[model samples]
Target: MRRPNIVWISTHDINPDLGCYAGVWPGAEYARTPNLDALARRGVRFDNAFAAAPICAPARSAIITGCFPTSIGTMHMRSKAVPPPDVRLLPEIMRAAGYYCTNNWFTDFQVDLPEIVFDDCSPEAHWRNRPTAETPFFAMFHGMATHESQLYLDDDAFAAATAHVAEADRHLPADAPLPPYYPDDEVFRTAWARYSDLITEMDHWVGGLVAELEEDGVLENTIVVFWSDHGKGMPRAKRWPNEAGLREPLIVSWPDRLPTGAGVTDLVHTMDLAPTMLALAGLEVPEAMQGVALFGGEGALRPQPNEFTFGGRDRQGEADDRSRTVRDPRFRYIRNYFPDKPAMIHTEYPDRLPTWAAFRRLASDECQQRARGELPSAMTAAQRAVVAQSKPSEELYDILADPHETVNLAAEPAHLDDLERLRAALDSWILEYGDLGAIPESDLEERWRPGGRRPATEPPEVALEAGVLSLRATTPGTLLGWTPDEPASAAEPSSFQSEIGLPAPDGRSWNLYTGPVAVGQPIWVKAWRIGFAPSDDIPVRVPVPV
Candidate 1:
């Protein structure tokens, strides 16, 4: 059977605000995303897909590894200094199955993958570059036009990018609706309008890629997947555990394999994509994968529809916050580990926006007034309450009743039973996954960075026994590589490079070397951890038969 080609197109910081999502907010209709809408019409649109982590690096890590970021100690944004070698990425597994993999130069893996994972991983990478036309391919194209940083661009930069957007489409309604938490002011309205225009630009890129597939005559045999990393780039949405932060737009199109124009209301997590792709390719999903394949043939590990999905948040940039949440179909429960911290903590990135700047100005003025023994006068009492309020330990919201999640029902006696049930579910999940977020960031840094320096990998031990080479490392998850020792003068440039062999069998240390070698030939072996310093090379000369 011929394996279907897979093309994953991912965007940054976008939620389901497209026209097809039926967003009722003012100016939502101006979100010109006809390409995505058409794709939804010709494919399966997932109504309840979520990111396991709210931030970029952590969320992308979960998607690539089929495990929660917290489980792998990568929950902190941009904190994956070194990869845990034991964790095998999805691309590596696909490559092992004879699939030619390529990524269009955007990787926030948060963990180091074996070099063998992608045949090409650069701006020029494409499936067409594959040596054989018959080779099944897996390609990922990342679209950054809609990224949150685009919102903060200076006037000139914004103009250069949005010049193509028609003037009428660029302006939002005067009374544009915003989340309750945001101040309904001109700055926010303009921001939302600009964001909508960026999404339209992203849609254009998506259309171009699909058109290319059609032109190549590969559309019929390809499975195309489109999704965003997390939620909208607004203040409350990006880093918070609310629906806006976790919910994502997911559409899958595979001609003749799945029903078109169908909407699946089943709750799904981003990590599930790894297992789903493997299962669709008729390969075995790894036992360590925490996600379940939602669509595959019989014998696939399909999760129960509408099962509760989970999300988590950790350190984002300079702000240190820890929160976890569990969401079923209608109800959402959140637990803030550090309840004493205010929601408006000082973060450099968000502070760039006028909305955040206004809050900070009010907060600063309030601090000065307190210093003078006077009550705050800069902000209204309600606004001051929101700015100064520390988060509650527990929050419960009926999403069906309060889609904005503005009202908290945790204190209500009528919802005690529901709150307890969801709280218990969150606790069980944390324990089952061995959540690393339970450990403080300072403590983790000490362990992961001993002596105040990045960790160093331990060298793998090499031995020759029974005419076969054996390699082992004491550190768990250390990846091993080896090459035949060659002199500088006689060796080609590529000869100095070592190939990463199969991972340790126990995920700790043990990889049997399988290569043709004559007795007395010397080999050099080394160890590496994705974000850390590599181990020193060890040379071992093969022994002659006695």
Candidate 2:
């Protein structure tokens, strides 16, 4: 079979609360996801997919690079880390293989990137923009409608955001399912309802995209992947390195080749997405990428199936904590580097949520009641964990027995073997990967950017000889980008252009410069090294044949 076009639809802050996974996960009854459910029926559903980190930037970094956040120094939220010398993003790899790759704007990869890594990386980017009908394309559409910000908006704003949700699909605050660890209150309930409405809205958006692919007559020739960045955006879920935080819903559908109506419970990490995309495109998986291909048919570069998946967390907004986790099919073990810090430590962003405000109020009330010698406080043990002053150094949970992970069995003698096994696994991973989070942020910053100055790529040197164009960059690891199209103001250069005699970099039209191009017209070229400023655009005038 020919290589299939890949279209990935990524949504923000969602869990497996869909109709197709009704019996497999919680809150399915509350989800109105007919579009996703229909897609799932024609595809394979992953029941145990987890992200490298619970937060967006880190998790997205892992997905784009096919390496763990810690492995690449992108473990901390919004932290800019120099990629290891050998790293290349997934889209770049695919672009090298002649795939027309595009990302619909959202690129919270935590690390800086070359402007031409994707053929198009704008809100208007689409597979239809590819140069030819024969070209296989890789397109990513990001859904921010389901992001955490939606849940915290004021009533007026929230209503406006979810106004598209049908009345039947809309969830009532009272109908929201309560997590055992969360306080049962109107604040949490309202947030939960808003989250559900957002999910439904995002599902509708997905359906629209899928319909577009079908209408274009390429649905059968394409592999459609749907996944969320992480789990729910509620407290203890968005940033915490727990199952509720890291587990994500993944569904892959290819009507022409793969089996339909299938569900796989095999452990899969979101990092694997990069390699999987390469494998499906008939391209070799890079050795630098740590994650193995999960699917690619025979002769594909898939590694031995993983027995355990790992997760990590570092600084997030105002909260600074270090935690790493390893999970097998039945048990999950967590090691907290900062045992003195509470799990619910205040963060500037989440603090704005009404649910967080309610949590603070309830915790304060509980503390006062306890100080007054009130016996049997109304708060449940699970709820009290939210206000605990500190966390244990280690935690072990039997996932099968306690899906919510409310009960920690780290100190239990009976589960000592499981705890020790997972502990050793996590330790080995940390030792092999080298956690950059272990270094102080200030120290890491100094190492990555000396004198606190971000680096810039040197401009690309160009040559035009015998109707062929070639370019090179002085920077050792810089990626080159070029476009043959004339500049927007080429007919009349701008004031800045007149001074420099070169057009400003029009980033949207750039293509990864993999090789020499047959020159017939003027070309604009630039260079960029990851985590560095792009070089100024340089015009390359075509030479007349002697």
Candidate 3:
């Protein structure tokens, strides 16, 4: 039997709010996620899937590498740098295993992906573009309609923005229940309604992709997976380390090789997806990957049923905060590295929301009244907690009892044992991963930036012999490529770019150059180590005949 092709559809910031998850507020039917609902009924739904990090770039980096972002020095929100040279991405592994891979234009990869990793990586990237019909493929489609920015639209603007949505989907019922942290007002309700509409829109995109698979007659042979990058995109959700930030919806369907309609309640992290994909493709999971495969052949790594899943938070955009969390099924423990920093880390994106504006006004009003020696009675304890600058270093929550994470059980005597246990687990995880949060953010920046003082990759040695050019690097697995040194105004053709691999079958690290070139032509060659910066370009002139 042929290997199954894999299709991963990922969305932005949506938690398990789908109708199939059975956790949607007001009514499950209101979610209008018929496509995903049907997928859940036809596939395996993971009840306890979580992200290694709550924010986008870090979470995505963890998923793609099968390693904790902290371990790979990609814990920051927008590091805009590639992982260190030692780390290998899932696509690279899959490509090496003879699978065609494509990322549909959304790689918020904190780490850089080499050009060799994917056959295509544009908005139009798809499995259909593979070189041949017999080739197995892995493709990822990222949808952004349900992103947090969708909720930033005010009531009047939301109506205009979502005017394309059916009127029935445009508004939520007046009695819709909201999270206790949010005020029970129209602004909050309207925002929720708009968010729901965005989900519905995202669902439509999912349906379209599924239809395309069926139309291509490859649906049955394709393993379809759907998931979100992280938790919801609200104030206390996206950047926080609570359940609201870490939990994600995950569904996997493979009609030919696996059972359908199965529900997995195992605690699995998003990092597991990479190794799982590798296992599914009959490839060995690299030892450097920290996550287990969850499913595959007997050699696949699987975590225990009650094993704790870990999460971390670090500098997000311009805001700097550090926190780490470890959770089992019943409880979650959080340790804030910067206890003096406020729970609210200001970023320009969320500040645009009307709800966030109102929150800031209320907090400002309460502060002004306090400065005047008057106790503020209008703000609820929950509201004050949202903007409080100082927080306890440790927080323990009985997630089963306090799903919203409003009450801290860290100081409660009744849960002291549980707190200690989780605290130890978190500490062990941090040490095991070599949590990058231990380093100051400014220092990390200096170490990771393009010209920063990080580890250096020695440039390839270029030598011309017997009318041919040879390139070799001391760095094992360095990827070498070259282009002609043409005039600045000249357009370089695609043929000018070529990858040079190892020359001899027994040789360890040498690219026996292949060239029979015209005289007087100049060429520039460069080498790249996955986790380190590309080496300086070396210009070599095609020698004139003696």
Candidate 4:
């Protein structure tokens, strides 16, 4: 069978609030995710898909590496991590297999990745841009309409993002359903409405992309995977280790190899996605990858669906609280390392959002009112618990009965067995993987950088013999990337470097070097080690046959 083209579309900070998923959530009625719903109907919807972390960078790092962020020392948000030797990126591996890989704009992998990882990685990137129509391509599209920044963006910015959605389709604040943790107020309601509207806008974006696939007459030959990096961008949901923070919508549709309108309740971690894609492409899932392939892997590489999914939280922006969580099919258990710290870590980034600001106001009002022995306050105790001074050391919640996770049942005898099971599981997983979050960030930085400076990969040495080029880098675990086309001019080299250094169009004819290449002309080779700056390209001229 010919390898199928893979198109992975991801939305930002979104949960299972689509029109599908049984339409049970508060904003589901207003969330007109027609495109996503249709995709779900034609694909297998993973009802229990979760991310390795609640935040974007950590979760995305795990997704790309197929290893938990904690295991790779990337658990902290916005922190750089040096991947272990022998580990390679999914796109790099795919490129080696003659696949045209492209990422549409976003690549916050939390590591210093080389430019040659993708053929194109800009907003203009598309699978159609591949050199040949017969080449199988892997394209990643990021839908940012539902991003957290959209919730607090200026009116003009928000207007432009959701301009495609009709005014009639926009949700009303009054009709927005309120979560149990949020106070009853207009600000929170308006936040919900805006989020729902953005989801609709994202749905429209997904529709357009799918339509393009159909127009190209490759929809049947392509595998469409739609998912979110994490969950809702609300205060409690976005960064917390609870269900709303970890669980997200996952839809995989491949008309040729998969069943239709099926719901898979198996526990799937975002880290598994990398290995799964590799397996689907008829490639070997590397032993370095910790995740199991969901679809295809022979004998020793076959996937074993998890009985429980694990997640972690640490150092989001300004906060330093550490926590870990494990979720079975029905229950979630959270272990807070710093029970003295509040669940709401008063970070400036989240405080800028209107919803979080409203939450702070309500909490403040309730505090003052309670001090004076006031009869009633705007925030209920359940709502105030999030903004409370301290958190419980351990929390267990029966998510089926209480999706909001407001009530903690860790101490309850009725749920002792379930709690213990998950606790032991979390402990075993952490011990096996070695939680990097346990180490202080300062110590880790010192170890990684040594002297507070980012490491740079040594340039690769290129040799040409008998019209064949051989490349090697002195640095351990360095990846070499070469292009048969050299720069047109000296000035072009810097421009090419800039393109690779930043998230710009990488249209250069770069190829991942797996072995010696038979080149009859000059070639440009560069070296890069993960978590280190890439080396400058060196040109090597191959002898031409006379």
Q: RMSD per prediction, one decimal?
A: 6.2, 4.4, 6.5, 3.1
Count the clashes in each prediction. Answer: 3, 0, 4, 0
- In angstroms, the error of model 3 at 124 is 1.7
- Ranked by TM-score, the better of candidates 1 and 4 is 4
Q: How would you encode candidate 2's per-residue C-alpha lDDT over 1-546 as one tens digit per residue?
A: 467899999999888988888877777778889999999999878888899999988999899999998888888887667887678888888887889999886777876546578887767889999999999999999989999888887778987888778898889988888789887777788888888899888888999999999999999989899999888888778888888898889998888566678878888998888988788777888899999788758422233358899999899876999999999989989999999999888898787677777777778888788899886365688887876879889999888889889999999999889988998999899898888888898998888788998787889888878878788878876888788766554245355333211222353477778888886877788888887767777888776657
In Å, residue 207's CA in model 2 sits off its true spot by 0.6
lDDT (10s digit) by residue, model 4, range 1-546: 588899999999988888887644445555778899999888878878899999988998888889989998988888778878677788888888888999987777787557778888777889999999999999999888999889777789888989988998898888887777887777778888889889999999999999999999999978899989898999788999988899988888887577788778788998888988887778888888998888753312233478789999999889888999999978999999999999888898888788888878877787788889995467777887878889999999988798888889999999889988998999999888899899889999988888988788999887787877888889987888888775643223344334223433345667889898888777788888987877887878666567
Clashing pairs in 4: none
Tens-digit per-residue lDDT, 1-546, candidate 1: 799999999999988877777742223455778899998888888878999988788899889889888887888887644445556688777876778888886777664444435667657779889769899999999888988888768889998776656676565646455666665667777777778888888887899899999998999989899999999887677888888899899888888887788777788998889988888888899877888888867322244543689989888889899999999988899999899997667788787877677667777888999999998777655356457658888889998788878788999999999999998988889888888888887787777777778677788776677656777876676656566644223122131121112111111211223343333466676776665666776777776657
In TM-score terms, which candidate is top? 4
Clash list (residue pairs), candidate 2 = none
Give the CA lDDT, 0 to 100, for residue 101 in model 3: 85
Model 2 collision count: 0
Indicate the worst ten consecutive residues by lDDT in candidate 2.
496-505
Q: Candidates sorted by TM-score, descending order?
A: 4, 2, 3, 1
Scored by Cα lDDT, where does model 4 land? 0.84
Write down the TM-score for model 2. 0.93
